[model samples]
Target: QKEVEQDPGPLSVPEGAIVSLNCTYSNSAFQYFMWYRQYSRKGPELLMYTYSSGNKEDGRFTAQVDKSSKYISLFIRDSQPSDSATYLCAMLLYGGATNKLIFGTGTLLAVQP
Candidate 1:
């Protein structure tokens, strides 16, 4: 199985709707879980990072991690057109020398005007 897997969704929703993105991983050795948002061709910007199993909330974004199930999710509230972007979930190997991250394929989100 792939280390990380996510639906490459072109999920479209109305403005002000709630958006949910998710990812699943097969490795239990991953110690860091992160969510990144990318607009078009630009590089992804870190949205949230959780070191272990727990929930982290920032602004309208909430990140949830479940190490027992090896799953992670991101929730976006009060969604807007500006929030339309590709969301990527990433994980880093534990005790690795470098900070290399393994990424999911990404999900495309579009908030209608």
Candidate 2:
């Protein structure tokens, strides 16, 4: 089974709506979790970063991690059309010589005006 599973959503929402995206993992060794937003044909930029398990909120975006359940989620408040992008969830396992981020299949988000 894949270490991480995400909804790979073309999740559609109205501009000003709240959007929630998530991923579940089978691996419990992950020590770091992150959320990245990538525009079409562009590289992803870090949106949120958390160590272990916790919730971190930034502007309209919130990221949460549950180590016990091996689940993570990203919440976007007041969605905008410009927010349309692919959201990626990534994690790092501790034993590697260097942290190699394992990423999920991105979830595509579209905010319609």
Q: Model 2 misses residue 76 by how many Å? A: 0.3
- TM-scores, in order shown? 0.95, 0.94
Candidate lDDT values, in order: 0.93, 0.91
Find the candidate with the highest lDDT and give its number.
1
Off by over 4 Å in 1: none
Among these predicted structures, which one has the highest TM-score? Answer: 1
Question: Candidate 2 lDDT, tens digit per residue, 43-72?
Answer: 999888898578889999988888888899
lDDT of 2: 0.91
lDDT per residue for candidate 1 within 72-107, as digits (tens), equals 999999999999999999998866577679999999
Clashing pairs in 2: none
After superposing candidate 2 on the true structure, give the runs of residues whose Cα lies further than 4 Å from its correct spot. Answer: none
